[model samples]
Target: MIIRHFSSLFIAVLVISVGCEKTDRDRFNPLDPLNTTTGGRPQGLQAVAGHERVLLSWADLAIDAVTSYRLRRQDNGGNETIVDLAERPLSATFIDSTVVNGQTYTYRLSVLIQESEGGVIQESPASVPVEVTPGPNICWIADEGLTQILTMTSDIRAVDRQITSIFGAKHLAVDPRNGAAWTTTQFGGADGAVAVRFSSKGVIDRTVTGFTFPASVVVDPRDGAIWIADIGATVGEESSVSRFNQNGGLLFKITGFSEPSGLAVNPNTGACWVADRGNNTLHLIGDDGTILLNINGPGQPTAVSVDPTTGDAWGINVATQQVFKIRSDGTISLSVSGFIQPVRLACSALDGSCWVVDAGGGQVIRLRASTPDGYHIGQQSDFHLSLTDFFVPVDVSIDQISGQVWIVDRGDGSVVKIAANGSIIRRFVGLALPVALTVDAGPR
Candidate 1:
């Protein structure tokens, strides 16, 4: 009975000892040299371009038992990796070698001490993940009407956001509901591409791989699906149009036109207008991809915009500067002329004016309501970034609330935000070579 009592007491002591044991992992410091002078604060860490390495650094602590710093990385959709710690306070930055491009990587930190800062060692909170990525695969945009002008420049490289795709892209349309941008990549080197949304900042949401190249894109307000004009070739004898859901699911594909270029969705009519530039025609398709009206017109009409107010459609001639009016009967009428290299068009939601981007003349001409319209030159402004400057601009969009205008400079690879006074406020770089800037400011 005495032996049994002794055994019970021994087991209790063993359990107590195991619970009190400390581990090496519980004692390491963060990658940054903790600065107690700043109340043990750390600062000034940077990530270099074109590398997977992240430099972690901090100031040394002023009055605590900080001996070392520990660094760890958290990858939300990938494998977790730990960065080794520094034994002493850092003079330079510590490097983390296990990061990758195009992944959501975040970091956590801790401090190792002599048990004086506290009775035990403790870790710090993790930081919000820093997303590292390379570049976008493709994006779609509306060609704010310039292709109709005979004197228009054929330089596709001016407004092309992808460096690899210089002279082969057209339009840009953004889905304000879904925050996705769709634009047409032209036919030159890589066939054509369409409907690439920015899933995150500077990252494309391309979920499919094997589909043929696409042209223009517009998101359906009814079902949130993306409709694309898949010409497949610039000079093919036949072509088709396709539809994709917001989830990258291939919903539908329809073939009819010889070559499809421009796409416009009418809200009131719930119809999609497609410009058959190859056959010099326009086809109005219902929501279910059924053909409603096939309008034939003058030589190769490129740019088209639907009138929400009247259900009318306007198009630009690739061989001439004439803006044609497309009646429901598919008849064409000349509206304007004397345009220099007119290529793309955007109809405004606020004033209902049509903004034309003439890449050849380096000018953005605005036409207020209807065909046979007069042009109003916007405030010609200089775009400044670092030391360089941009003279001519391509596409433009405005915020309805603040009345601020944003434009993309084909001369420079930058997008600039302009005040109501046409003064440059802020600029964002690294967009390859931006030609168009479209914003989806929600519900306005």
Candidate 2:
């Protein structure tokens, strides 16, 4: 009987010991690295703005535990995209290039961890949201007849900010230093002719008077001085070239031009080149209103332009259907003929080539700096743009930012925008007269 009692005690001890072992195994924590739970959320999430991109960065929670990271981005329009970055946990940096300018974006970051046995993923909570806005690309155009300046997108969409109260606004020049625009007006009466300055936001910053008929205006990019081609009351009564400070104070006036139509400043040398239609000559004037050189043209020179890259000046003769290229030293390098009453000319600062408007031919011609025929004088045009739908194309301007050409057709009162590939992008109509048009790269 004693032996049977001892055996029962041993069996009871074995049962108790086995129960305690099972309890310990059931209390194991699943949050351990060998299990399924992940590390803490990523910290220090950041989104930096760029031209058309956003850079994302974050701090890693546990480098050894994390197998990868996930990034989430959302735009202002509520569009969301999730990206999985495998095997990139430490020093995590990502660039989102599929973004547009002038847009805002939000971002979030999280880390992924794997279980030691099953390789299952467990993601931590995302970091706090970050936001950024990219820089926008825009352009501006001036309408002389309507006395308004229109701001446009890269694709020709008009913005809400239209500059008004500019009376008889003729030609416009945008300062490269600041995006400010300068123009000449003939609207104020006998003393109405003035040079006006407009800020980038379409506000009139200042106005300088004492001009009889301010036909053309330009700003010296080097010193920010204002230059005006003041065509006097009578044909040769008071015609002069005037210079003014950034404020409305007159610096000096050089009189001699009998009908100055257009003017351009040499960015390299700071010299002002004017086209005098009355004398059929192109005059190169120094910054102090002193005549430096006189270049005689084939006929009446109506418009002038200077290539900033090479400091070469180009002028168009309306009476002789010719284009004159003057070197930086005031010597005539080459004079090409074949145009039909070219009214205006402009040279690309980025490239040495030029564009001229032909009113008689109803077309625009593009000329290269060097001719393939090896002749420096009187070479044929590289290409001619004759849009069948356009008539009486008088003035032309190029947007350096977009590399697009804009033409003012006086016959239809329309503005035609052409792409760099010679494709007609859009034709803006409903304008009255539209005698002159100038473009400004509104903001970067």
Candidate 3:
């Protein structure tokens, strides 16, 4: 009986030892780098601001041991969300395109690992949190009749601030980096023609004078230099484009062009594209006032713009009643004929698509360089009526972030906002001859 009892006790001891061994094998080591109680967390996490997106990056743990990752985000309203990677990413970067402007968000990242032997999942402690706040992509409109520059949200909501007494303000440009604006006025200031700069709050910052007829103004997105296409007293004679610092000081002036009626700055390169209507040429002038390339033959190019995404230039030839696109290297890419009068054109910064305002057709047309055979016409609100006396759109601008288009309806004395598909979004009426406008891509 004693022998049997001893054997049973030995067996019980053996069973307990085996169970303890299994528990130790499956248990996580606190000293292990992959341990959830210790290291193995993602480090150096970063968040960058984008138009309507947030870019996140981090230094992940070793790929051999890591199974996936976890991203946690907290919005301003105290709402939290967690995102888990289905599979490990080749790179440690993710783009959150679902964000909106004017909202603040905080983010955290953690490493995920699974034990090979036990098939037990473990999550490392989260990394340090990072915070970022996004935008206020506003639109600045130039009213020739009211002699004012108005600011509004991309959704066509008024910004509650307007720069007054800007007489003959036919064209305007806003610096996205600082929210400052520059415009050309033909009749208000001490000089008959001047390039005026205003602070973000409707206060006149600086007024650069000595221009015969400053037909167009633009701000280089690469550098905050203001450029003015001064079409001198006579067309084609003494016409020049001048560059100025943010403080209204002259940087340099390039002369010897006829009727420099329009100016567009290349966002990548601070260079400017001048449309000389008198000479019927498009001149790509370097930032330092050097003539880079001159492409002849867009018959009387009245207005010009550059697509930030493609670096291509789009111009409207009112004289030829056509719209054309020019490659950055000075070659004519596509020229589409058949318009009563295409007055102004604006290019999408996010895409190479161009929007043209055909005054005679009373239509806003969208052109894509990839598909040269066809164009999309933004449907006006009165499309069903087929009214001949509809609103006459004289100028066009685009919100780079949202891809929405804003048109200046000089005929109806109103401004209209439309989607990229040409459906009317909203309209703001009762303005005095809204001739020109620009959507501010800068952050407020």
Candidate 4:
């Protein structure tokens, strides 16, 4: 009887022990790495902006006895950046503070199943990349440049310059920040050479050289790189684009231009619109020098302009005395005719106005455009902007800000600054056989 009683006691002990083991298995720690697949994975990760902060949130995230969750971001190069939070399979959010204007950032959503002692729980494969770009108020100058010159490209000038260089200098571009003026010597340039930087006082601050027959020059606002088109092939050689830092340090030289004459760089698109006069065409080059499209025309096209707002290209043909409206698909159309060697041009983003310089007849013309290349003064898009006749208007430029016009008259050796309606606002006489004219909006 005593032996039977001892066996019964042992059986009871075994039963209790087995029950305890089952309980432990059923309640596994949710945070344990093996427990990560407890209820599947996180879903619907979205990025939301909250007053300078980015909030990364997810839905239906499963958690049990976990310590924390880990979040990460993925860059365009496929690198991972992180954000972390504590505890629970519950849905969660992460607030990101490292965001600013003019910057593009990408992120990936992930869940971290926290480990017991140290180190983080294993993260799920990065969620599809989510992006949020913060916006800031930008002080952008309305590029009402040569359009005003085109409207009045021909009129009342001795040296009839193109609108962009309507004054006495080959106004290359305007410093986007402070609107300082830049230009080059037109007649004989060896390379990516910058002849002068006109201060607010109209004084030369710097001169840059060391390029190959530079034609059009532009400064990048993002990295502030100076890009100049080298027309070396014009004299029987290959052509290229010379890139330099803002301070004049040479960066790189890009080849494959055929008599490239004019260029306009869109800061927004990072695309360069180059006028390849060799084939009477316009080549839209990427920021990295890739040609997006090659738009051809009926004549030798020289001047190029880009509408940053609409992403359109305007090719004004000097040889054919016509303007070609170029679509992004490499399509071209004759927007207007009867241009007398329209050498330079500009467009106003403000009122959709346009200007052109006719060096052939010493005239400055204007066309009020509703769209980038779609403009008409009455039925004729080509209207003589000048009330008086020009002897030789070589180049042209216009001031959209002040509604003033600046022109270089080669015949009179003078630079004329006029009001919007062809009235002489101010005249600079005896400034050489003035070759070009551009408005310096910075100078009051």
Separate clash counts for every candidate: 46, 1, 3, 68
lDDT top scorer: 3
Q: Write the per-residue lDDT of candidate 1 for residues 312-422, one digit (tens) a residue.
A: 676777787655566656666446554566667655555555555566666555555543433223222122111124445666555434444556666655556554444
Model 2 TM-score (2 dp)? 0.65
Candidates ranked, most accurate by lDDT first: 3, 2, 4, 1
Q: List the residue pairs that clash in candidate 3.
A: 236-258, 236-259, 378-422
Off by over 4 Å in 3: 1-135, 235-237, 373-390
Q: How many backbone clashes does candidate 3 have?
A: 3
lDDT of 3: 0.76
- Each model's C-alpha lDDT? 0.54, 0.72, 0.76, 0.57
- Candidate 3 vs. truth: CA RMSD? 17.7
Candidate that beats the other on lDDT, 3 or 4, i.e. the better one: 3
lDDT of 4 by residue, 1-444 (tens): 999999999999999999977654543543233343443335566775322456676664445434455677654566667766763445477778776532446776556554465765566555556665432211111112222122111222122222334222344565655545555543323433344454433345666775445567776656666677877786676798766666667767777778778877776777778787887777777776576887665478788776555666666776757766665566764377655567777665555455676777677776555433443423453443543466667666555454555666677655665566657744545444445444434322
Looking at model 2, the pairs that clash are 188-192
The alpha-carbon root-mean-square deviation between model 2 and the true structure, to one decimal in Å, is: 16.9
Where is model 1 more than 4 Å wrong at Cα? 1-172, 182-197, 200-206, 235-238, 327-334, 370-392, 397-405, 416-432
List TM-score per model, in order: 0.54, 0.65, 0.65, 0.54
Flag regions of model 2 displaced more than 4 Å.
1-99, 102-139, 189-191, 233-236, 372-389
After aligning candidate 4 to the native by TM-score, how far in Å is the CA of 70 from where it should be? 76
